[model samples]
Target: MGKSSTSVLVILAFFAIYVIWGSTYLLNKVAVQELEPFMLASCRFTTAGILIFILAKIMGIPLSITKKQLWNTIIAGILFLSFGNGVVVWALKYVDSGFAALEISAQPLIILLLMRVLQGKKIQPMSVIGVILGIVGIYLLVSQKQIIAKEESITGMVMIFFCMLSWAYGSLFVAKADLPNNYFVNTGYQMFTAGITLALMSLAFGETWSAPLSWSGGVQLSMVLLIVFGSILAFTSFNYLLKAVSPEKVATSTYVNPIVALLLGWYFLDEQITAQSIIAATILLTGVYFINTKKTLAIFERFKR
Candidate 1:
């Protein structure tokens, strides 16, 4: 591919990561209305995993890995998919998709704190302020009268908080862990491992699969979208972006996704976007931008002065 072609494809990949991923939150809400959370997640991942595995094989990518690496990938999958995604799926029963996305937007903040605590990394003062602002944003979001009107909403918000923490830890671990060099192969294993674990959880929890048989066309379509667009396409695009762009650039998805989700939720699901939500989203995304680009932002400020 020529340089211009490559650049266009990179932009498309970024679009997939930002828009498709944001849309998944609302799709999950639609899917879980009829399907059990664990079972729904299991089916989505298993299908996507198998499809990606086949694609990897077709591309002649090696699937071999050490037992230790396999274990590490499995653990990472549990953290990311089972706890991170599965909990959010369950919480969708009580929370709006937009609210869930907003809550998840705080992942960078949590990851920074986790790194500081676990890796003993020192945080700059601006990053510290960013984290504090993120916390305040979350507080403003969940403290709204609409959110606190229901007990289950509070539970859902709390669940999303834990989901962010799990996802952050999984991301940090996977960054340093031994895994397949091929992104498709590595993600295949991770999704497969997570699928199997969620399947077991579905069985243990006595979740019925027959519910999906009675689902509406909209719900069924949402599941297909979640599997194909949300999981497969978006994930592959993300992996591609990690190779093509700087990590900070890829991290902008965290800022863009919540806005996309909020708009979609309001348009399709008629989910309310209150003043508090807008304010919280502004605060949260601004903090995220600062956290991700603190040095650049500081330099820009210097130039302005």
Candidate 2:
């Protein structure tokens, strides 16, 4: 592919993770309300995995992968999907989707710290400032009296934190790992294996499985969107971005995701948007901006002399 084509794809992939993934917070919340968390995740991913494979085959893309690549894909699947996203969906049972998205806005901060510790990368002066702000933002966001009052919400928030850790590690892993060259195949293998893993988890937990046809209309619709957009498009874009841009820059999706999720949750789901949430979101996003501004790719850099 030409530099121009790659640049265009990069832009589109970023958009997928930013805008499309933002809406998934609400979509997952909707499905989790009526369906078992792991089961819902399992069905969604398995269906998406099958669809992705089918689409790839139809496009004459090769599905062959080396054993090492397959293993890496499974590991990636477990980290990114089975535990990272599936567990987050489960946590949505206790926390409002918008609130969860806001808390997760600290991801870029986590990724930066991981890079510092794991890769011995030096944090720039501005990044230190961003770190301080991110810490403050997180403290403010989680310290709300109303939020702290609910034990369920507290548990959900804690689980989400660990889920973030899993995703952060997965992001770092993907950047360096050798995997299938095709983004679609990479994502398909990950989703398929992760879906199987989630299915096992659901059965172990004694969660009853229900057919998609039996789910409520809203849940059914949400599952369709989740499978098609969230699992396929957004996730493929995520893998593509991991390879195209730096991990910290990819994590900037959190900045826009929370805003999209917050509005959708408020408008469609009647979720509360507290003053504290607004303030925390501002601080968190500001911190993310400071951390990423220097690293962000110029859209027209390829064309520049």
Q: Which candidate gets the maximum lDDT versus the true structure?
A: 2
Model 1 per-residue lDDT tens digits across residues 146-212: 7899999999988988988888787667656677777777778888899999999999999988655
lDDT of 2: 0.90
Q: By TM-score, who's the top model here?
A: 2
How many clashes does the backbone of model 2 have?
A: 0
Pick out the ten consecutive residues of candidate 2 with the lowest summed lDDT. 296-305
Q: lDDT of all predictions, in order shown?
A: 0.82, 0.90
lDDT of 2 by residue, 206-255 (tens): 99988777888898899999999999999999999988877878888988
Question: Could you estimate the TM-score for every candidate?
Answer: 0.89, 0.96
Q: What's model 2's TM-score? A: 0.96
* Models, CA RMSD each: 4.3, 3.1
